[model samples]
Target chain A: MEVLDNKITKFREGLAKTNLSFREESLKYAEDTLTELDFPTTRVERWKYTRVAKIANTQFSSRKDVVKQLNLPIQDAYTVVLVNGYFDKELSSKNLPEGVEISATSQSANNLLGKVATIKNEVFTALNTLYATDGVSLRIKAKTIVDKPIQLVHVITGENTIATVRNVLVSERFSEAEVVQVFLSENANASFTNNVSEIIVEEGAKLVLDKLQNESESNFHYSNECVQQASNSNFKINTITLNGGLVRNDLTIDVDGENCETHLNGAYILKGKQHVDNHTVVNHLKPNCHSNEMYKGVMDDQSTGVFNGRILVSKDSQKIEAYQSNGNVLLSDSASINSKPELEIYADNVKCSHGSTTGQLDDEAIYYLRTRGISEKSAKALMVTAFISDVTKRMDNDKVVEYVHNQLHDRFGWDF
Target chain B: MIKITNLHASINGKEILKGLDLEVKAGEVHAIMGPNGAGKSTLASILAGREDYEVTEGSVDFDGVDLLALNTEDRAREGLFLAFQYPVEIPGVSNVNFLRTALNEIREYRGQEQIPAKDFLAMVKEKSKLVELDAGLASRAVNEGFSGGEKKRNEIFQMAMLEPKLAILDETDSGLDIDALRIVSNGVNALKSDNNATIVITHYQRLLDYIVPDFVHVLHDGKIVKTGPKELALELEEKGYDWLK
Candidate 1:
């Protein structure tokens, strides 16, 4: 393998030096893959709608520091804080439950890190694999039902910086837990975050994860979530992105066993020159499995949104039911969306469906509301709220929902 | 309570209401009986500030205020309501929630405080009953999946909640059954008062039989061709609109 691209060489040389080390074997694999991979361009099918030239062509510095006063959405949850891609022990919550273990990936001996999230074909995953500073490592013991939610807060600070954060979560057999991962920024500019999360749900285990990305308008965010589910396991993830200059999320779920349930939902609100792209794939390898995915977006000003959802049912995966839908609302003539929902079924006895809709708000509905003494602004707000409520209501966490509503109000002046 | 003079309106450069004039005093119900394409709905729409129509020459006076100058919501805030012929279905927006918003915004426009949650709920309960509307329907999405009769009843239910001074029922009886029409008329009659008036735009005399309009006007060829007592509805019902034309 040879690294010939000068852009890749420049980006690699600009990364902050890492004093922490991980498994030597995994690191070698990542190094080899990184040498063979170049920065993706528009020609790449997966990164077609997303452009990485802004990240690749710029020089970035990595700096770490502890800050005072970290405002969290869920305050009562067991919180783990990471500042500038490094864990800050002084800020994390202490006194975990008996059956739950929460530690930084740099401190934990995690064998499942590179097993689920492959760095074979993806360049960002390889980059995160080689130079990840710190991330969360959460493990739930078998048959243990965690009483409280666990939150991981990743805060990026400073200007012209890059943070590679990698996380691994393992839910043992018959365990149930809820985890929230929030990406926030503090006085940051021209920053980039490359995040990769590897999740494993054992047989009879259930895991629910909520991810909120609210970075600054000048930051770039890219995240990859790789999940594997055993037989009789259930996994659900909700991705809510409120603000960012540029964001791309890649999520893959591999259902390797029978009788598993998987749900993936996302909602994004964009304004200004923001851009958000979400690509998700769900592969069903066994029978008697169910998967449902829905993503909704609202774009205003000159913003753009892209959604690509794929569901693949392998041969002999009988009795598999999969549904995917993407809906978008453009508030301005300059705003736009590109949505494609694809389903591939190799089995004869399977039910798979996909749909995509991109349009403006219902004009008749707006007029109806206006005739009832509601202002045009409020009418649009109400209709947009109703449009995205399908995914937001299914968030199932009132605190998170309230926080999102508050953010909407603060950012866009939408009363709903 | 309201008066319109020489209202000329058009949509897509095609004239709908040409030199149309109407007047409704306090404590009266006027039924507008018209054939198809006679500008009945255009009159109702222009009064409620539907933007699709271009009002070439018109002046609407609502209690000495320029009704035409206000926007749709402002016109609504000024106590003018239009019960649409086809009520829109707004999915996921509950009837009660939107009604509360409309009522509060109207109140705010009138320099009043927000309604208390308890009192608002009580009002919803009372108003829904007047239209014989099911209590569950008030909490459901606005007109979504409602039967035709139920949608008309919901319109009446909204009128009862808002308590407008000049309510224009534009073909509110079009899709209603006999029983539903009676229920809706009864609700409208119960809400009538000396301070408010109603303009009932209908094609039949059955609704007038229940609500008992004070006067009936035959609208034809973009204008009111004739006006008479409530018995005029009976006459028009007996002899078709051809006699007036």
Candidate 2:
């Protein structure tokens, strides 16, 4: 307790040096939480494969007046940008679709702090809750569908900056919508990002969430996304992480009501010395729920990839069907991958299975293509594209799929 | 157009073809039938330039040039085609795309302009009918989930598309039913001309019944034991390989 108290005192002294707008009580809460809690280490079961202390030990500086100017090349959506964990009202507007409401919640908002108190055991969540200056709160009305997507851009700049952003989304009954959250950082500067996103879907609501992470080479990022679904709701999530320094993403979904359907799909492309870790958990709390998960990774150079997925079907969740798969391709000998796909089913009448495969490009397929007069380089490129096309084509969004394909081409130096 | 002088080949340091000699002229169909361990398929593999098989002592001449000097793709682009005994199943590669690539590669090797897409589609439609292959099947991954007869017909379809000078049908009749055999044989017959040659490697005389060979050679113990006219296939079928052995 004394060691933790000393650490908390040091952290508060460091926090006092930054000119952040926070209430004294919130600052006291942050210090109290830091003193009471211990940072997650390798000894923890969930954090066994990924070590976060490497970043926790580093000192990060917070900059005041570090404004960001974001110009999204992609159009046809409402854009919201956050600079250094602070929501920029000047750059972000409420030009949303009908029946949708978006607003910023400050630390003083009623019930906001208590709503996140349940997740205090999550160190990052507690930290973000205590220090989050401002966050976005979005709500969609019942029986209304939003045609265009809602885009949220989290931009981080300056060196040694530690930032946290929080988001909460609630979908009314039978509402259908899509949201895209993008995390971007400029250049190779040491930084840390801690983010928490919570989503809840009412009965019969359909929601699609796409998370894109494109961070700088010298940053450490940890994100937690929690989604809960009601009866007959449909939920789909597509995560794309490209070129990150040290990134860890935790996606936890609970089908709390009957007859719900969920799809979790992701693709990660890592190069250089980057390391990307994805941990996903899907719990079937009710009967007759279905879930599907597919994650693919392409690791090049000396990069590393880790995928840990778990599906749990409760005792009463009979007739629940869940499938999970993880596939990886290592382009260089120095590249590494650690994948674990697990299923725990307490229900007897459930069809649940999981599979994982890690290997190099198919040599026989490459040789077969080459024997047909195709060049060796072209053959390898075609095989690689075909291997990844299975996951990309499932997106069903032509533009997004094309963007991923182009990113793959840029990574492999292939024209198509 | 093709000559093999004392061609000796081995796989895994075990000799398969020892001092085998054969000549395939233009506008000819030759059938090489042999017992199981007679190195018949090995001869086709060596000719098509499979890397695992080493040519310890051999010289092959194709179109008045050294054939063994070229790599696998170069040999393929130089108008050589080998219909495998068991066609490899390439998942996620469309049959139409594979055929188009092979065709354009051969065209580029010959210094000819590429065939336009419209013409290529027209040619595919025309050749697909020759092998009785459904138009829908051509759009699927190559040889993936294909029936035995469909796989054989697809081989002929590819042969018609590539139109190589020397088409070696390695056991094209092994897995085919009567209907598939007729379609494959008819496709082969239609593709054969005075400018191109075919080498039909089979274990039975059934395939030769439809696409009759001009010459037949019985291979035994990695050497050509007997050379005769097409009627020799029927004779071997009647007496079986025991008499030849």
Candidate 3:
């Protein structure tokens, strides 16, 4: 067999020891789906700007090492720690709220673990489903408000290792909570991470999910998140991609009920031949729903960035309000960005608008600053900061805002 | 405090300032009056070391240094300030923060101590009051959402903070009402000192009523054809530039 097929055969042989009935069923479905789909290339419409040939040709194997002790994210809430995509129970928080449930993948008794994200057409997600051995299954019961933020920290520490994690989160009726998922690595290693998250927000529930991806620059990271919202429920996802070699995020949220709100905001900064892509889909399937998405990027020194926002308002979805915008700045002559904001509306009574803008710093504005005695360097930094201010203001958490702001400042050498 | 001789400049091969000569000493305010397209603002831009204009032939001396060779920020550091005809609106950058940064840049060039936060705040309060700028506007972004009159006042407010040796007000009185013009001119009169100079570029003599100029030069066809005292402004304001043409 070819190496690609051999990797699949090796993956199936490893998954032969699955014990859970639902997971075992999902593994079979994943195996069948993977056979039908291949890793996406640039020819595909949805991934026309991203190239994934290296990821497909690389020799990847599931690798793990028991980390006796590790430092978790500094947070005041329940912490779920994962090393090499396996849940480290000894390192996670033991004490929990009365209605909030957390468990390991092998011992999970939750029925909603693999029930949310059922889209099998995505190859990466199917690969994640077939190879993910352990992850977190969490749910908040009705009317339970978790004051502290539940943080899931994923650490990668190996070379040529492939780690896949599957996270399932279901917030019941009227429940409100905040969750922060972080990806971090200590060294520059050639690794691959395929993470899939399935989230469900039932009637009147509100959930705030934030993702911070700061992996090694030599690694490839891909995440596919699918969320479903019911009537009067709200879901918001804030993603900040700080540093990565080849990163692609595909987040889709289905607004399936009336009077629902969905928001997706992301910001990225890349330099030195780095590549980042952000693709978001906000689907309004019912009447009286609203969706908003904004993504901004700043690339320099031959780096590349792509932002594709697709807002789909179904035929039966009346009185829908949707807005999407993407703005990018290319600081170097060789740096480039491709931004496309697409809106597909079938509803007659919908108000939808989409726009995108890509350009360099305003020369007139730069000259204005220079006449004020500010150096050209400081002036450029200030203008770039101003360019991303609107997107940064969308972040709700102060700590996360400060963290992202400091990262951008430190990365762009705008610390002054 | 500044001298220019036989200054010739152009934009895209179209000459704007042709053989323009001017001289200003300490404690003097000179108003260069002209009609539209007479290159009045072009002269101001060139003096502040704007790059858009190609100085095919000319020279500018600021206090004794070759001002034509300095960069924009370097000219600003050496005490040349140009209040733009259309002040650029920069959102997300606070007015006070920009002023403080500009002040520190000038200070750093002079090898002076950076101002403390407490002193900076005090200076903001006092200088903004001098220009009659609202306390709220001082904390907001630089000229973002500001009215026409407020933007002109902000230009003067920056002038008050920086205390430039040669301040060129490009059309500072264009969009202001009579009352705004009076208040803005009052601020200019208050800042006038023996060691510093001001160049007021205007189209009307109404502003000359408040901040009286020592010399009034008429720039026609890229050259100053007439130079006189303050009364010359009234003559042109009544008869218009057609008489000179």
A53-137 in candidate 1: lDDT tens per residue? 8888878777887778876779889899998889989999988998999988888877777888873568888888877888888
Point out the worst 10-residue segment of candidate 2 chain B by lDDT.
B97-106
Residue-by-residue lDDT tens digits, candidate 3, B1-245: 99999999999999999999999998999999999999999999999878989999988889999999999999999998888889999877888878888899899999999999999999999999998999999999889999999998999999999999999999999888998998899999999999999999988888999999999999988999999999999999889999888
Each prediction's DockQ against the real complex: 0.83, 0.49, 0.68
The C-alpha RMSD in Å for every predicted model, in order, reads: 1.7, 3.7, 3.1
The Cα local distance difference test for each model comes to: 0.90, 0.80, 0.85
Q: Is the docking of candidate 2 incorrect, acceptable, medium or high quality?
A: acceptable
Candidate 2, clashing residue pairs? A61-A160
Worst 10 residues of 1 chain A by lDDT: A14-23
Sort order, TM-score high to low: 1, 3, 2
The true-versus-predicted C-alpha distance at residue B145 of model 1, in Å, is 1.1
Q: Which portions of model 3 show Cα errors greater than 4 Å?
A: A1-25, A65-77, A89-91, B239-245
* Residue A197 Cα positional deviation in candidate 3, in Å, after optimal superposition: 0.6
Residue lDDT tens for model 2, B1-245:
79989989999999999999989999999999999989989998888877889999979999987999998788878888888778778777788877777777778888999989999999999999999999998988888999999988888888888888899999999978899899999999999999999999999999999999999999999989899999999999999988877
Model 3, position A86: C-alpha lDDT score: 79
**Superposition error at A258 for model 1 (Å):** 1.3
